[model samples]
Target: MTAQTGSDGPAAPEVSDRIGGRLLAMSLVLVLGTFMASLDSTIVNVGLPVLSVEFGASVTEVQWASTAYLLAVVAAAPTSGWLAERFGARRVWLAAVAVFLVGSLACALAWSTASLAAFRVLQGLGGGLLPPTGQALLARVAGKSRTGRIMSIVGVVPMLAPVLGPLAGGTLLEVADWPWLFLVNLPVGLVAMLLAAWLVPHVPAADRASRFDLRGAMLLSPGLAAVLFGLTDIGSAGRNTPIAVTALVAGAALLAAFLAHALRADRVPLVDPRLFRTPPLGAAVLALFVAAASVFGTMFLLPMYLQSGRGLSAWDAGLMLAPQGAGAVLGSLLVVKPLIDRVAPRTIVVTGFALIIAATVPLTQLAALSDGWLVAALLVRGLGTSMIASPVMTIVYTGVDPEWLPRASSVLSLVNYVGGAIGTAGLAVLLELRLTATGDVAASFSEAFWCVLGLCVLALAGALRLPKTAPSR
Candidate 1:
């Protein structure tokens, strides 16, 4: 096969030609890095109470360990595209893994709450680069044609993180100290780095002479950080109080200014806002926002309902949620991928959202703690989520210029993170508001499920407008 430049730029003929050999190996290497990075994002939560007791800190004070990491991740995402362009994805990825490993070690060694929180910030900086860079690399290699199956593989681990994190954390705490939580990343990181170095190709970097969008970056990065921080506070506090409101408003205003700057700028900005003008890309982004809300929202709500409402243990709650991961993985491989290569993304996405709504509505009517009905609902929820996420994400890269993949990847990553935060916070607030008035666990959970169902409906509406087919390269 000959290399051909599309509306984007040079296609990855070299990598595409070797799809059965080195390309598969490199994909696995990148997937490994992404899985670890994504896992760390949620794995510390079950250990939070443990850390609180160990450090003699309160719940609110201890949360900053996770919050600081999230803020750092939001701040770091907008920079990943530029870093990949200037330095090449392979080099930047290797460095990211190394930095993550170092940060993990430092976190394990942290003696106090403040120290662990600070080290988490360090970890976040490295972790933030992994997702976007990995996506961009895979996008460049797979091009538009194969993004469906490839992203399915890359996304599977992250999708499983929420389901697996509490289980992993609880197990670790059961057997060892809190330090082991961070230390667990050590062997994984090392293996990923070695595999990446050995199997990944030296894809050439973009021209380094483009004036970096320093001013836009200044606005965008911190704006995202603020918005995410505000939302996180809302989720934790279970309210949209003064602090959350102020931060959200301020962050929204700054982001608006950045949007104006990016649209009007003569030079390329950090993320090319014009990409959103494309119909398919725009629709895909909207679907992504909704998809993220449903995924994170349900994950947040289900566990609370199981453990706090139904009085199950953390470990048991995690086990009950395990079927969601199984259904999601099965759907992605057996259903989403095949449909993507054959059917319209619009059909797949709309059907997926419909399934999500159908599955979630049953949560409102759930009566018993140990009913097999809950498991059945979760499995359908998983299938629906995989159907929506995998297809929408694959179509996102279709028709884009290859040179723009890095920035596009960054934009998607930022949106997913932000959307998940919003869903989590919004649902938590909803549940809290219901409980305050009613004090009924089942009623409050039902109210939250209604909110989730509404979000899924919005997603379905957006999916209706998606391109009828994947954009031709």
Candidate 2:
């Protein structure tokens, strides 16, 4: 396996202490960019009901606003590492921010669902770069020892965004119109763009630059896109059709082709297959995928249970969900650092998954009747989720060498998104099937929760492969 290399080289000079100031500035820019990108993912969700009415579309059709953005991000993510390697990080960062700004404007001006989806694609193309580039910048700025703390802070953005999105969207929708949901990104994106230009340090390419693996990128991007598209289509189709069958078959073929192309390429492939050879790295990736799916899939189902099953309003659901986020912050602050210091990552992960299993078991007992106990169970589940996030991420980063940190982090981040996408879709499929069989939406959802719980158990199995002890700093 080609071990990860630290950002810059082993003996690269440290940024001056003045870098402290620059780091603060750069972090703000990154957080702003992330907030805008993540907000759009869930912000449009609340606006969807209103949008359906405004555009004369069904709720099902309005769902495409989120789906298209996700697919677009998946399609564009692989190219981020290459872009940073070719152009300087600053240039690529600036360009992506600009693209996001333009896309946001287009979304505001969109006259129909079709136009809005197209604009979202543009927004996603830019937003996709943020995760990978953000990690790269963080790794370059903060040395390895500090990486854990940096990532711990970075991790809070994704957790908080979903909670913040509805509040922002509701205010915007109430004060102005649904288009303002998209318009809100404009000023935030522009400020991020300017600050990034000023504060993000530029690392010039080393040794005349690596050749861009265009063919590999072409194969891999479309192949993954096809797979995600197929999965989403299955959820929409509700039954197997020739078109769906063809998409699945084609996606598999394309993915196989992508693997072959990456392996055969003379230059470093778009994705370094060598990273998977390390057992810890591979296991970390798998654990991340499953954990993300379990967590996000539950997030999707729980709110629905509260709203559709219990008849709570959006605001009440948000308020009820607050404890989960609170638990996450608490875990990050109290548990993650000490856990990493004292326990083996495998132990921490196993414990975390066990906690998740414990938390989820209570969910199976939920009924159509409102119960304070159900809300309390969800609060515990959120705590378990918080315990899992940072430690698992720390494990993934520790396995990688410093130089490859950016790429490894990027891949790991992408897998989390991919997992969430698949998990949510798969649970939706299962819920629908069970609903048909059982004639109870709540019961169907409960069965789906059990499936998610089973996946968490599987994740614990993967966590077993982590090193018995933390890697030396």
Top-TM-score candidate index: 1
Which regions in candidate 1 have their CA more than 4 angstroms from the true location? 1-21, 238-240, 368-370, 470-473
lDDT of each residue in 45-84, candidate 2, tens digit only? 8788899999999876777787788878888788877787
TM-score of 1: 0.94
What overall lDDT goes with each candidate model?
0.81, 0.72
**In candidate 1, how many Å is residue 413 off?**
0.4
Where model 2 places Cα greater than 4 Å from the true spot, the runs are 1-25, 162-168, 237-241, 337-343, 368-371, 398-402, 471-473
Lowest summed lDDT window (length 10), candidate 2: 3-12
Each model's Cα RMSD: 3.3, 4.2
- Model 1 global lDDT (CA atoms, 0 to 1): 0.81
Clashes of 1: 2
The residue-by-residue lDDT of candidate 1 on 377-417, one tens digit each, is 88998888887766767776655677777788898888788
